[model samples]
Target chain A: MPTAQGGTLYRGREGMWSWVAHRVTGFAIFFFLLVHVTDTALVRVSPEAYNAVIGTYQTPLMGLGEAGLVAAIVFHAFNGIRIILVDFLAKGPRYQRVMLWIVLGLFVVTMAGFLPRHLMNVFGGQ
Target chain B: MTNATHGTPAVAERVGTLDAPRSPYVRKKTTRGNYELYSWVFMRASGVVLVVLVFGHLFVNLMVGDGVEAIDFAFVGGKWTNPFWQVWDLLMLWLAMIHGTNGLRTIINDYAERDVTRGVLKGLLYLAFTIVVVLGTLVIFTFEPCPAGADPELLASFCTA
Candidate 1:
């Protein structure tokens, strides 16, 4: 009775929403992964090309980009972990809110810890 | 069969189906749930973030300066030698892994009907996730672009004497 529409979960309004996200992120990650693997293959492709690619990313803007990437990964990873737990291990609906909050908390904690270091290196002394 | 005038209400009726709920197969019926809503929000949020992350990566690596040709062990080695690249790489690794895994989780849930089957597949997913995340995080935080001693050919120029 605690859920959106009483205690029954499947009947709730959010099932489709979750389904959509899973699909979108799934493909998004796949595309990125495919490109990533190919690009990293540059290490084997030719050292010159690899070096070139590396040099470009050394920019401060790119550093900001990477920070966003870290945030994405954290959200996806932690949420995925939550889904897995819900589907298999816990199988308890009562704990979902708690899990969500925990995921959010961890994400904040990680960013707080990493961002300062990143900024310091980017803007601080040589 | 459930008749409007007679005996038992159909299974459909119980779950609010237009027809009477008759299926003995119907287990517990839930009137509603919120899990799906969160997922919807997550997709949009992740999508926006992914757009930035993915494009940022592409722009920097493919569009900037000397571009694709400049990437190499020494180039990469030099970059990773810096703390910034290490963090950048770390973020990319973590995001892709998590996003992909979550996406797959949805696929599994939607397709798998049997609880036991779902459990097994999800178990495999979790196992793989753990291995990848652990190995990846370790590699990023502890990456040694240039080791202490290695063949001159294999080592970056900076690594060699």
Candidate 2:
């Protein structure tokens, strides 16, 4: 809960929420990485084997999952840069709130550009 | 002024030398090296590189041409056949695995209140990290774009009949 030592500063603020999101997204990505590596490894088995597995990823359900995965990656990447700035920049702590907003803005723009094109590929009946 | 003048306090201050210790006990030297420090630095460093590598990967695999629909055995075969992509994937695999492992280690250290729980979680984490990295690495290096018996339709376009 908020009773923890470091929670005093981060509790009930953008700092705390962003930190939470980072951890959640990171855990998701790490597990996905394990599965991804295993799937890619199917290439060594045979072309048919690889395609058989990857074909599942092209389904509408998995397309939505891929979108979520990409969204997690985008947010994590931007917020990670924000964290580095907070750690290293002279004015980092002072501007961390503003930086979080910027991170969100970039996340929105990136996903906006990505989703339409990606959805088309997924559901465009090609 | 009176407290300063009062007692043995001023005497001890004057008598104590900077070069000598008041107690005979010696502090033990730290055997714990800067492993955590290096891990911290690696997360940040690898993070920056991963942003580039992962974005490029997604862009190529998902956002280009046919997008996710374009991905399959032939798609993967075509990309891995290129030395540039081979190196790219290899670096991404190792860096991402290590970075994620270290991050999870920090998380386990934070949340796993019990020593036994922490140790068990980290043991599994490292095991998974090793298997994935090894599997991914071998896949990238040993991938055959065109196997003799594979369906030609499944192989990359450039693969000769």
Leading candidate by lDDT: 2
The most accurate candidate by DockQ is 2
Candidate 2 docks at the CAPRI level of medium
Q: In model 2, which regions exceed 4 Å deviation?
A: A1-10, B1-29
Clashing pairs in 2: none
On residues B20-126, what C-alpha lDDT tens digit does candidate 1 reach at each position?
A: 55745655666777777786666556655655665566456534544433455765667777887777767767666666667678778877889999999889877
TM-score of chain A of each: 0.71, 0.93
C-alpha DockQ of every model: 0.11, 0.66
> Could you list the chain B TM-scores for each candidate?
0.66, 0.82
Candidate 1: regions farther than 4 A off = A1-126, B1-36, B65-69, B153-157
Worst 10 residues of 2 chain B by lDDT: B1-10
